[model samples]
Target: MRFIIEVLLSGLAIFLAALILPDSAASVDGFGWAILAGLIIAFVNATIGTVLRFFTFPLNILTLGLISFIITVLMVQLTSYLMGSRFDVANFWWAAVFAIVVAVIQMLLDGIFGAKPRD
Candidate 1:
């Protein structure tokens, strides 16, 4: 249930980010494509990304987690490649911007859907 919720929230974030970016920079065909793209991204992150993170653990720590952001950008680009015309990111900078926007929205969604601690 939690995993499903996360995926849906991610898709919503992606859709929102696509709307935020100019059409030349990034684009999503529709909400359904956004969801599918998000799923591909999640799968890619879970598999390839996890291994990259593991290998770069020391650099990640030394860089104070900046490397993870790079990984996120790569995942976004890969997602675009996997989805073809359904989702597109023009270049690295736009992909980075999209990644940041998606991250921010996803953070907000998690906070809202997350288990709250009792005061």
Candidate 2:
């Protein structure tokens, strides 16, 4: 349930980001592409990203967690690379911006949807 909700939120965020930053973020011809990209991102972040965070713990701590932002950018670029035209990030700077915006929106959505109700 949580996974499905997160993926939907991510897709919404990606679609919105592409609309807002057309020069930086792009989805191929349909909302499906954005949804696919979002699923890919969620999978990568859960698997590879977790290992990366574990290995880069020192760097993340040293940089006061800013390194996690870089990791997010890499994840976004990796999605573009793997999906080719289905998803595209203009460049590293653009990926950074796109990733930042997506991350912020995802966090907010998760906070709302994943929140526990008080007794």
Candidate 3:
């Protein structure tokens, strides 16, 4: 199903983040938890992130869209806390870096899967 594929893709993103960021730690043994965390993250980003972005449109514009990284880090921290997973990211900076890596990996996967429409 699409949902299952998305979850797996998210887990792959998390794994890639863990691999790419030295300070970001994730356990392969916690794949189920990672999937659940990813689902929660996707839901929060879809709902809360959308609302926050709308309200912070001015800041987003002023920052040239850089503030999105902060939002992503916060969402990741929230997901980690909610899941009670041992996956540990040291600080906001590390979280941001990890998030960027995850985003890149996700985008690459989406490209490979042709999930995103080509121009």
Model 3 agreement with the true structure over 1-119: per-residue lDDT tens digits: 77678789988888767766664354323666566667878888888888888888899999998777678788877776666645666666666777878889999998887674335
Off by over 4 Å in 2: 107-119
Best candidate (score: TM-score): 1
Error of 1 at 74 (Å): 0.4
* Per-residue lDDT of model 2, residues 1-119, tens digit only: 65566667788888778777875455544578888999898788888888999999999999999888788788888999999987898888889888877778777777877755445
**How much is the lDDT of residue 73 in candidate 2?**
84
TM-score of each: 0.89, 0.82, 0.80
Compared with the true structure, what per-residue lDDT tens digits does model 1 show for residues 36-89?
Answer: 999999889999999999999999999999998899899999999888999999
In candidate 1, how many Å is residue 2 off? 3.0
Q: List clashing residue pairs in candidate 1.
A: none
- Reference-based lDDT, residue 88, model 2: 90
Worst 10 residues of 3 by lDDT: 21-30
lDDT to native, each model: 0.91, 0.81, 0.74
Q: Per lDDT, what order, best first? A: 1, 2, 3
Winner on lDDT between 1 and 2 is 1
Model 2, 111: alpha-carbon shift in Å?
Answer: 6.9
